[model samples]
Structure formats: C-alpha cells, structure tokens
Target: MVGAMSLRPRILSSFVGDRFLHSTPPLHQLFRYNPGSKHVTLQLSRTLSGLTNLLFNRRNLDELSNNKRKSLKPGKVSPRRPVPGHILRPPYVKSKQPPGIASGPEVHDEKGVEFMRASGRLAAQVLEYAGTLVKPGITTDEIDQAVHQMIIDNGAYPSPLGYGGFPKSVCTSVNECICHGIPDSRALEDGDIINIDVTVYLNGYHGDTSATFFCGDVDEEARQLVQVTKECLYKAILICAPGVDFKKIGKTIHDHADKYHYGVVRQFVGHGVGRAFHADPVILHFRNNDAGRMMLNQTFTIEPMLTIGSSNPLMWDDDWTVVTEDGSLSAQFEHTILITQDGAEILTQC
Candidate 1:
C-alpha cells in the first residue's frame, strides 16, 4: 500500500447560478467525440469556480457529469482470515497500531540487497497471480483470499493485513477509488477496472507493488487513463539515479500526464520500503520542489495515481476506501526500485 500524507477534509457543495458553473455545459456534452468509438471521451477544459476551486483545491468538474455511473458502494467486509502459526508475521501485526514512516532511507548493503530482492520478487509473483482472477463475477474478497494463501504458502506475511488496522491482506481499488481500498464482498461488473496492491514481508524486509486491470471490455477513455498512468510511472522511474534531485520525479510524471489532461493525485505518496512498511523520503507524484536527493543503494516505491476527472478524493465511511469526489475513474501503478550505481533496479519483478 502507498503511504498517505496528512490532509484536511473539504466540504463539497455546488452553487447554482455561479458564473463558472453557468458558463459550462452539462456533463453529457462536455466530452470530446471519437469517430471510431461510440463512447464519448471526456477532456477536462476548465477548473471549478475560484471559490469552489480554492475550497476543494481540485480541477473544475464542469466537464464531469454528476449523473455518470452509479457511485461505488461499500460492501460487507469478510471476517479477518487467519494466517498459519508457523509463518513469521511483521512486528506491526502484534501491536495492531500503524507503524508510521520510519525515519531513514532504506539504503542496503550487498546482503541486505539480496534480501530485498527476495521479498520484492515474492510480492511481484503474488500480484501477477492475483491479476488473472479479475473477472466479472469474482468478489474482491475472493481475490484477497487467493493472495493471502499464496503469500503464506511461500512463507511470507502479507504486509497490509494488520498495518494501520487494514482488514484484508491486499488492497483492491476499483474504478473511482484512489487507493487503500479494503477488499470486500462486492462482485465486479463488466467494464469495471480494478487495481490490486500487493506487498510481502520476508526475512525482515518489505516489498510493495500494484497495477490496474480491466474487468472485461472497458471503454476506450478508461483504457487510455490506465495506459497513461502506467507510462507516468515508468517515465518517472527512468529519471532516477544516484545524486539526482527527487523533485525531477514529480516533473516527469506531471508533464506526461498533462498531455492527456489527466489529474494527478497529490495526497498519497510512495516511500522507502525495507525494514519498515513505510520509511523516509516521501515520494510525491505531482509537481513540487521538495528538497531531497537519491543515494546509491537506496530503495523506494514510485506509484502514481491518475484520474479522468477531478483529483479531489472523498473517503468512504469505512475510512480505508478513497474515491474520486466526482465519481470519475482513477488508476494507479507501482513498483519498488533500488537506486544503483548507474540506474535503478526494479526489485519487484516476476
């Protein structure tokens, strides 16, 4: 799971007869038509009014129709699944409290690097297996069950299970959900998109990664959003090396997402993952000038969240689930990487 930055909740309300709202067309007419596909693809034109924009601090939703598909509803979360007694668990499991970001970079020696690679490979393998079960009728809870079994079968603990009170072993974010979506009993439908985040703890190290998968036949616009979100992650990774300014990651991701007019989520960020679930040097996905530098042999994750509509997030009552305020689709991709002498090595690859 990606770590979240502290944020204040904002009130959401639309004022009728506002100049900006009046000037904009209805949600249905705001999309750009593609002659090849019957579906209309939305392109954000302007942000909401000044007052509302400042209050929400997100793009104008003038282009998004409030009457889009039904908003995602929370389903009943299953009882917590048990792990085998023989499997070693992370320290946080016993505390039942969130172990906040540890205060240091995860720079590793040669032996530590080997351990990191082992955990990362396990995480990637579990995630790959979880993707194949993303069909129309399967519940996210079922996917969690499979992932949990796979992780323990390999003698590793599922990292998200007890951290910060997360109920499930993995995170299943569908459609508008930005991140940290708890796996539940809701069955996916055709055209729905889901992001499964998998992390594993092995030999005192942690590996984290995630990717969005199409449930079935997805629309062209949603497909483009997922594709660009992935490109944003790789493009950001390409620029990482020893002595590079960390701010360059934000610029690289923000610049590419701009070409497709996708909104980059700002609150959640990637972080150093090794001995701790979340570690030092918070990695921001949007444009910023934060002061930090990459060091050789250091490790961290670079997951980027991109949206088709407003990047503003509304948390579900469950507290673990986060969704787009406008109910538009959001997609994310993540990978744990090690900064090498020349470039970064992707630790979480199958």
Candidate 2:
C-alpha cells in the first residue's frame, strides 16, 4: 500500500485547479503524448528551427560521407489515419486536446488488476506481431501502418496515436536516436538497429512495452549493447519489492551499464501508467536524490535507455524525437510492472 502521507498530497495537488496539467510536461514529451487544449502551449521559435535544421543536415551529410554510401534520414511526417469504429480511442485522441495527467499511480483493486492483465497481454501481442516485420528495405511508415491495423483488429487503440500529437501508432526509434523516434518513410538498411516501442490502450487502461530489434546482421558491438540493455532491465526488476527504495532501481541499472562503459539517458525516466498514459512517481534510470518507496498495488514502468557514447541527448527540431549527442548507437526495453504483496509482477511480459 502507498503510505498515507504519499496519497493525500498527490491527490489533493492533482485536483487543485488543473495545475497538474500545467506542471508536468505536456503529454509524454519525454516518452509520448501531446497536450490537451487546456494545457500550456509552447511557441515555436524560428531561430531555433533554423539552427536545428542546419545541425540536422550537417549530421546527415557527415554520416553519408563517412560511410561512402547513402544513409536514410527520417522522411516527411505521415498523415494521421483514422482508427476503426470498433476500437475505443483515448480521450486525447477523441478531443484532439491534452488528456489531463493522472493525479497519482492507480492502486489496482481486484477488478483493476484484471483489466491491467488483459491490457498488458494485448500490448505484448501487438509488439510481437510488429517485430516480425523488421527487415532490410522496409519503411518505418509501413511498419506503423501494420501495427495500427493490428491494434484496431484486436479492438484496442494504439496509445501513441494522437496522444500529444504523435502522428503514428507505434514509435520506431533507430540507431543514434535514443527514444521517442517517430516512424517515417526511411527504409531500414542492413546492419541497422531499431527500437520498436508499443503501447496499447485497452479496456480503459494503457499497457506500455518496447524492445530493440536488429535489422539484417548487426555488428558485435551493437549486439552486445542490446543484450546488456535487456540485462539492465532484468537486474533493475530484481530489485523491486515492497519497502525497497525506488532510487535503487537507478543504482542497479547504473551499476550494470557502467561495467560495460555504456551511458544511461537521464532526460527521460520511466513513469506510472494506467487510466492516464503517464502519471506519478516518475522512475529515473540513474542514481539520484529521489527517495520514493514502492508499495503494494502501485503500477509503473522501468524502461532504461542505454547508449554506447555520451548519455546526454539532444532534442531534434521536431521536439519529439531524441537522439544521442555523440551519435552513438542506443538501445532500450520497457515493461509495465505492478507491485504485489511479495514482489513485482511484470504485467507487460509476453
């Protein structure tokens, strides 16, 4: 159970005149989602856009020159498509506005637990189906289209769609891009690595999970990084139990990543998810001052992003995509988890 001290403050603060909507980053700027009309609007800066464009083009040119071959850059944004009539869309999707953030983590009762189980299972199934499509010469937009239809066929909504203005159903982040990489028309080449993040809104709740997949034949360094990244998630999950300091999750992850000389991304942390796509008790991936405690019935996620170079990430002009500052390879894995009477239950596990 969440301590009494933890419950009241969060609930009260969350309900105090829509401040929660303004305080937290609109939607999952770090993970996924666009803000509702009620949220604060960020003004686009022309100067910033110009600088970003220059840097982006320079980076692409450098990559092409180094390889002595053409490398693909993310293409034009895909147009939004409509969900099937039978699938239930999220409030944000229906209203085209920001869905207010959840006040706190949901302490699932008997019924709530079952809903989460079903949601997690469906999300995993969708991710598995999408994984089969990863190969040389396929555009990410095509991948998104397949995933979108699959979720609709199952009578579930692709959580990322229209949530915070994300154009695609699934997130397809490629090499050098840490997370939140939007799906585009870029054709994946042989030896490239991509991370497919899938989250589905089903039965009134959301289940989020992601995994890094290799294209054709990946190099030794890339393979090891992906394997180690998965191990980091497993080791962090091992530390989850009642009364354990939440900060230890970061410590354990950092320890494992450090041993291999890999960098852990700090800009984005795993978050609580349920009725609201993202919620309270933000889970950091690096050791820090957060002292929150895990308790029974609390549901959250622990998705760690690891890079082969600098952990620092830079935001692209588009504001949603995040890439490594040093342009090194990155890999990530995510699972929605629930705190139980004895240990953590991995709801998103297939």
Candidate 3:
C-alpha cells in the first residue's frame, strides 16, 4: 500500500531551497525494479520498507518549546537613569535670565510655571469653543474667525497667529494635513477629518490643546485612526508621572500604535511649555527610550500624530503648516500636562 511504501528522498542546494516557486527540486534519477534482474525480489522488499522506520521513526509533535514568548508580561523599568530630563519645582521658562537670578535647578523659581499653566488653560478653552464649529458646510476661514475672536475676547494673543509670521489664529489641518493646518477659505465637506491645534498666551501663560473631529460622514478608517490616535495620546499621558523617563512615554505610545499598524510621526515632538511657549524639555514620542525623565512639578505635552501610511511629514511654504507625505489621512490629540507629587495632572483636561 502507499502508506506502507518508503518515500523517496532528494537533496537540494541552499539557493534552490530558498527559491519558493518550485515546491520540490527536480530529481536527477529514479530507482526501479527489473523483473529480469537476478535480485529483483530482494530489491522490491527493501524498497517497500518505510524510510521513517529505517531512520528515527514517526512521532506526534508536542507543543513547540521554540515558539514560546520570552516574557508573558512587560517588565518593570528602572527608576533612575544616567541622564534624565530636568523637571523644575516651581517651573520656569528656559530663556536667558540675569546671571545672578537662580531659577531653581529642579524647577524654575521666578513664577514662570504659573504663567505657562495659565496659557495652557486658555488654549484648552479656545479649543473647546472651536470644536463646536466643526460641522459640514462651514468654511475653515469662518472657524478661524471664531478662534481669532475667542482668543482676543479672552484678552490673550493667539500664539499661532503671527507665530514665525503665520497668518491664522490657529492651525486647522484637514485630512492628509498632519500639523499646522492653516485656517483658510476651504469649506468643510461631508466625510472630512480635521485637527484643530490651539495654543494661547494668556496672562503670560501658554495653554495648548488639539483634537481631531469629523466633519459629517467620515469613513471607518479615518474614524478609527482618530479614536486610536487619541487613545495613544492618553496612554502616553498616563505614563507621564513624576520620576518616569521621557523615552518610556514614546515607548508606550509606539507600542500601542504598532498593534494597530499606524504610522508614528517622527519629525515634530512635544515640548516644555511654560513661560516662553515651547521650552526646555523636547519630548519625542517613539520607542527610543532615551529622551529623559519627568520630575515633580515639571510640565509638558505628549501629542502623538498617528498616520495611516508613511510616517514622514511635509511642511507648507507658509513655513508653518505641516502635512503627511503619502497623502493618507492623519489624526492627533494633545493636552498640556502638569507633573504632580503623586502622578501627572493634565492642565488642559476637559
């Protein structure tokens, strides 16, 4: 019977074995029994013997020991590092101050943290108001107008307007545009996705917040990207407690994005925002775990830009607007955060 017969064996070179199309290599020769031959019966008997029995034998495989994962759970991270991002106690801007004046090493001394916190709050309030205008048929310019007036009404300047000479009151990125989306004449359409990034300087403090919203009838991919991107931001935020390292924040975010196969923007990073707007700590949100650490009372934002395709981004000629290179839709959410004694607190939460 076929089951009792010995299977033939063949040898293949490395290159031929690596080639996938040809399932089995061509055999140079074949064995056969000649009835006229003197030892034909003996040869037939030998051929009938199963090769597996001739070799080791047949056996059922147990669960693979080689397939086991190294660890069933994530490991604990070391608390201390050789180089950690400095978190100031009182919080101050990282600009040149008079030589004699000491901004506390761990925290800035001159009340700059308070100002930064205030700015972040104002930015959050502006974003919350701006989000209300995100409906179909509304021109981005009108949204810009509302944001401009809102900042002015609050008696604070819109940081994006005239920032490096930018023209809009806030950034209104749509669809493929990743960051610094310009507020312009384009009208909102059904199924359109947009990100509104707002930063305001109120009473000398900087508050920044951003959220991606749907215009009317958005697609599944865009909606999921926005939802997951927002979640990744929160995941990174939750890890922003005092004594936590900066590199780990990106590590957590990148791991989450990897699970969804979303692209992680690499060019732009979260920064220290207190007195001068963007300051000292440059927070990079990717797995390279070397950015630094968070100390008590230190403050910053962790905004992750998750993409549907390529991670590379482009900037518009206004020298302000940024977009994705592949034209795939992108989404982002940001919140100014404060590191507290026990854990990190989101200053712009809500």
Give the best candidate by lDDT. Answer: 1
Over 1-350, each residue of candidate 1 has an lDDT whose tens digit, in order, gives 11121121211101000001111123213323222221112334356333333443344566456535567899989999999988888888886556566668899999999999999999999999999999999999999999999999999999888876778999999999888888988999999999999999989899999999999898898899999999999999999999998889989998898887778776577888899887767777867667789999999999999888777666655556778877889999999999998899999999
Q: What TM-score against the true fold does each predicted structure earn?
A: 0.84, 0.81, 0.68
lDDT of 3 at 77: 19
Task: Using lDDT, rank the candidates from best to worst.
Answer: 1, 2, 3
Point out where model 2 deviates above 4 Å: 1-72, 95-101
Q: Candidate 2 — which pairs collide? A: 33-164, 34-163, 34-164, 35-98, 36-97, 36-98
On residues 1-350, what C-alpha lDDT tens digit does candidate 2 reach at each position? 11232111121111111112322433223221222211111122668534533432123435424642233366877799788777777787855444544667667888888888889888888888888999999988999999999888888999988765667898888988877778988988888899999999998999889999999988887899999999999999988988889899999998888778777776566877887787777787876656579878888889998887655556565546767665678899999898987789999877
Residue-by-residue lDDT tens digits, candidate 3, 162-213: 4433456677888877776667667777788889988776765667788998
lDDT minimum window of 10 residues, candidate 2: 9-18
Q: What is the Å distance of residue 66 in model 1 from its true position?
A: 6.8
For model 2, state the Cα shift of residue 285 in Å: 0.4
Badly placed stretches (over 4 Å) of model 3 are 1-117
What's the TM for model 1?
0.84
> Of models 1 and 2, which has the larger TM-score?
1
Best by TM-score: 1
